[model samples]
Target: MAKFDLKGLLNDRSVPDRQQDQKIVYRNPKDLIPSEENFYNTEKLERLKQSIKLLGILQPLLIENRDGKDYVIAGHCRRKCCIDLLNEGNDKFSRVPCVYKTSSELEEDAGQEDDIVRQIMIIQANCYRDKSDWEKMTETLKMENLVKELREKAPMEGKTRDILKDLIGTSSGQLGRYHAISTNLCEQLMSEFEEDRIKISVAYEISKLNKEYQKQACELYEEAGILTLDDIKGLYRQQEAEKGIPGQMTIETATGQNRPPEDDTEIPAETQIERFYESTNKNMKNYIIQEDKNMTIFMLSNLYGTARVRNGHLNYQGTTAGITFNPGRVFEHELSWQSLAKILIGKYGHKKPIKMVSVDIPEKPKKKDNEVSGPAKCITGKSKSGICGAAAYCDTEYNCCAQCPDDCNSRCGWLEERCQPAAEIPDEKQPDFVEEIADHPGEAAALPVMKNNDQRKEWLRNYKLWGLWYEDKNIGVKYYKYDFENGACLIAEEYILPGTEWMPEHETAFLHLVGGPEPECKGGIPKWTYHARYYKFPNSETELVEFLKELQK
Candidate 1:
């Protein structure tokens, strides 16, 4: 007999084979353990179950053998559908095709040292499926944690991030953002982010804030129903400003002072005011002048009932009676009358006697009676023929003096004066010709002037209109200016303090006195914005100071 060659016979095609290496095997659904990382879609699972019922499972579930139990490495959704089919009394779904791998085989398939490879497999399995952003973020976080754990067990020599970038299929920058969300964000915020209640970018930004601030921000979110990026940035800025940080934006007070944080006990009011004035310049003169005027009006209405300037005069219509002032010089003298009125009211109440006292007036220079000063002889000593002379007063000639005293239309001051109508006597009943005074009684004899460039800049630096500041060491008056209508409107804002709750009532009286439209208020607090029609720009520092004095009344 010929010796049997078993190896050659097995390889021979003539021999019938009874057994071969099996690539797939049917296993009971109850024996497989579901993966925690898998996300289920109900609609997709139902469609999958229908497909399985019709054609049977075409793909085998990938499972890992760990300690005598089968753990699903992939095909989790398909396994779930098979289990559902069996539960619905389909005995054909009781067992499903599975490709099994032992622990040693799995470790060999993906390098034992490369945990990121395993995580990558898990994430890549779901890549073809439609997953929500929340679900993707959760997977990204898991991958991030795996990378961190791998980094600790065996250092990757800076290749850990590169591995993460590969595993997450994102750039290095985006990988860092995912890592931040995983490491920094609290569990509650993470849940919110995952549920799509909070935006990922917003959650990342919120994570940058301190834990206490984050808690506060969450509370604010609950109250506001939503938190915008700008709102979050504003809160951050406010927090930074409160800490006296150098680069943070601060609230500018009306008196050109910064509203320091509540905890700044070491900072002196004078120092803060001085520093504020030093930083700002007269570039904000227009804003300061307008705010001062608004503050004046706000204060006067409170002290002297309904007070305002009408027809170039200070008009006061109070609860008891009405009084008027000619305000001889228009703006400053009106403030003087306000100061005087306040004095009278404080000293003698509303029944104070109103009397007119005779005051000496400055005499104008007397023109020589023999001076030949008519249009024929121009003020420049030029003859009318040489100085825009016309036959008679006419508006048609651009160079002609229409109101010339003489027949010749020469440009002469005397000619212009002679052609004007005489002035009317001011009403004696109303206060007139009061002396120019300081903003406060006995504060100073003369108002500071800004004649030169340096002086004007200094004035602007020290100027404050509205907002809270120390007024002789008090924090009652708080004001703010908001730009409206592309700078067409400057809104003066005022807030009532704890000790000075009556300030809002006074502000309401001022608003009513100005008489434009009622302010829109959300809470009980009232806000007032002076209309440009009633509030005109002041020309000089003296005018602004006097305006503030009138308001201080």
Candidate 2:
């Protein structure tokens, strides 16, 4: 019998146009290099090992040649199992079946094009394998980079997301959630999420908090065995509330004429870029722009998106929006730092107000004539001029200043704090009221008829019956019809709507808010007008009652 030429067979398999019926050949397990990437944990790896021992390599491995080495591509775990069995004196397992991948079948793993193609192949090959959320998220992020490159290299192929969807079975919305979770959540929380201890939706919300707050939320979850949106929101509200507490030291307190300084030492001056980077990194690390190789990557906080700057061009992608801009020149000025930030916000802010991220110095608060009286103790004994000479409190053990005296020249660092711009409240427009009511609902009489705008606003503010409220407890209703000439107030105690994947839209009562200035006809005959809107949220009294009950528990 003619000797079967395994060498010739393997060599023939490397040819691009080789026969379709490629035969599998047995090779020493040591000859094949295990794949570098490993997503399986020890438990899963052990299970794979046991399965291999039982099944005895029923399926052949896929191998590719790279730099004169046979590298395992799809069957990393199987190759590992063979090697383990061979090490245990199982001579039968020394040689395992593998099919050589053709040159045309796999990319050369060189250059950017090769890198993207290689990632797509690996992701598709492992699609059948059971993966953790973290692993899927990791693959999704890799695919995101591949999508960007593919778009740049082949702009006319298709939409970026459609290409990504083909490469990896993930929607654009899901990719955003994965990106947010991976970028913002702390390591502990991420691990918990990966291990299935936390839900992805809950994890995404928790990612909005800083690392410290994430850790706190994680601890709460551990104790309670459950974490909800309300819990996460409560923690967020607590964090924001701590920022502007009453009597708390403000930027004004440090630099004010009568407020004590944090310390007598002078802080070194920071450049605009350094200041912007430091403040953003400290407060909102997710939004902090990071330098990578020749490009910079920045996050769009409001839009939950990301963008990159390279070669004097900007490329941005978000959940609901995308943009590309080329200024024809690289930004080199200090002011360009802030200008660039504003440009990103303006394009992707989705009509939201601007974020105060620039390094602009805040205006100092005006002091009241009777805000403080009498001589105060200086907290820092060592002032810029000399020793502070306020009072005996300077000599006290605390050595802290109760307040800076009127004549004290000590420079306060309070002037350095970033100030949020005052919220702009637009003047309310009065609605044209109809003199006669045509078909007023009986409930319209129950609602107080306010004569003026202030009374209307006050009523809306005090309204606890049903309305969209702000996230912050102190802030009142989000939507109000101040100028509304009430035509009807319909309340649905129970609602049945189409259910979504997440949950039903409304299980509780909601308002069928029908109030707005009726469309007017300047010179035409009178006709009844009805402006109706639906509010399904949060505006429910039953929900609030249930929430309060849960809080009491």
Q: For candidate 1, write residues 27-139 as lDDT tens digits.
A: 88877997665553434567777888999987777776767888776778788888888889999988898876433322343345534545545565555566655676677
Candidate 2 deviant stretches above 4 angstroms = 1-20, 37-43, 105-112, 154-156, 192-199, 218-234, 240-553
C-alpha lDDT (0 to 100) for residue 296 of candidate 2: 21
Q: lDDT tens string, model 2, 93-201?
A: 8889878765442233222466555555556566667877777888778867765764565333456566566656789899888889988988877778888777787
lDDT of model 1, residue 299: 42
Clash pairs for candidate 2: 379-400, 379-401
lDDT of 1: 0.45
Best by lDDT: 2
Q: Rate the local accuracy (lDDT) of all candidates.
A: 0.45, 0.47
Clashing pairs in 1: 254-464, 254-465, 255-464, 256-464, 296-551, 467-478, 467-479, 468-478, 468-479
Off by over 4 Å in 1: 1-22, 36-59, 90-92, 101-106, 109-120, 148-158, 220-231, 251-553
RMSD of candidate 1 to the truth, in angstroms, is 21.2
